[model samples]
Target: NLNGNDLAATVGRVQLAKLESIIAGRRRVAARIARGLADCDGLDIGHEPEGAESVYWFLRIAVAEGAFSLSKVEIAAAVSAEGIPVNPTYRHLPAEAEWFRERKVFPPSDYPWGLPDYAGDRDAVYPCDNAVAAVESHFILSIHESWSDADVDDAVAALRKVADAYRA
Candidate 1:
């Protein structure tokens, strides 16, 4: 029942025609940023796995504990001050969502969570150490296909400046 209208279809076709070039531009920007930031200690600019290619929609950088004097928030703030857009990956964990905490995902009843076959306890507090660490340590940077080489360079420089300034 959900389908594109004539105008949407036309737009979709136009976008599809340029999708390859868009993806190539994104990949180029991401690769350049990655290479630029690769030498920064304590910062983890993710890598593409071998044999796989990614049209990176955004870049996620993880700050390792004890490697920097600044927290993730501090680092993100510093980068943002330099006019680079950055934000925490997740403000809160998935298990901490209101729907999950209230067990109201299906309304009237906790259908999925309370299902007899479900092993997870609706009331149980999940111990997500890794998830917590990631949420606390990771920041996201928006990358766009429209970004120029200078834009990529500026982002890299801002991040490096912050990291170097606060290296523990």
Candidate 2:
């Protein structure tokens, strides 16, 4: 397989050796971003759960509904306009996709769900309201191990500026 090739394996080993340092740098940047944005209204920079740690590859910022005059998309746009890279979180929900709704898997038939031993609903409606809400309300700010503290500070500033300007 391509993944097991000698060149890829050699690169992987090099990355593995520096993985700890990379993760540490990511954590430090994420923490600085969190602290800088802590006082900003209507934005939620999520926390690490008890006894858990995160490398914080993407910082998910949830904009509370009704907390701002602008929607999450607009807020993200405003941040992006300030030259900060911001994007809406996952836009597609599997439960709401056409493939899932039509049971298109395995073609022409429901397959597993249509089987006699299957106990689940064949025509299940998965509204996934919470998932939908989260997607609508959240935007992602990419964090990287190579990010300087100044970069993190700029992102926080842009977010806070947009939030403050649009607070309801």
Name the candidate that leads on TM-score. Answer: 2
TM-scores for candidates 1 onward, in order? 0.77, 0.79
Model 1, 31-119: lDDT tens digits are 89888977888886764569988887888788888888877888889889989988866556767788877888899999898898998
RMSD of each: 3.3, 3.0
Model 1 clash tally?
Answer: 0
Please give, for residues 1-168, the per-residue lDDT of candidate 2 as tens digits. Answer: 465988889989999999999999988988898888777879978645799898877888889889999778888888889998778676778888877888877888877678899999888897888777777778988788888878888888888889889999
Query: How many residue pairs clash in model 2?
Result: 0
Q: Show the lowest summed lDDT stretch of 10 residues, model 2.
A: 40-49
To one decimal, what is the Cα RMSD in angstroms of model 1 from the true structure? 3.3
Q: How much lDDT does candidate 1 score?
A: 0.84
Poorest 10 consecutive residues of model 1 by lDDT?
87-96
Stretches > 4 Å off in candidate 1: 1-17, 47-52, 91-93, 113-126
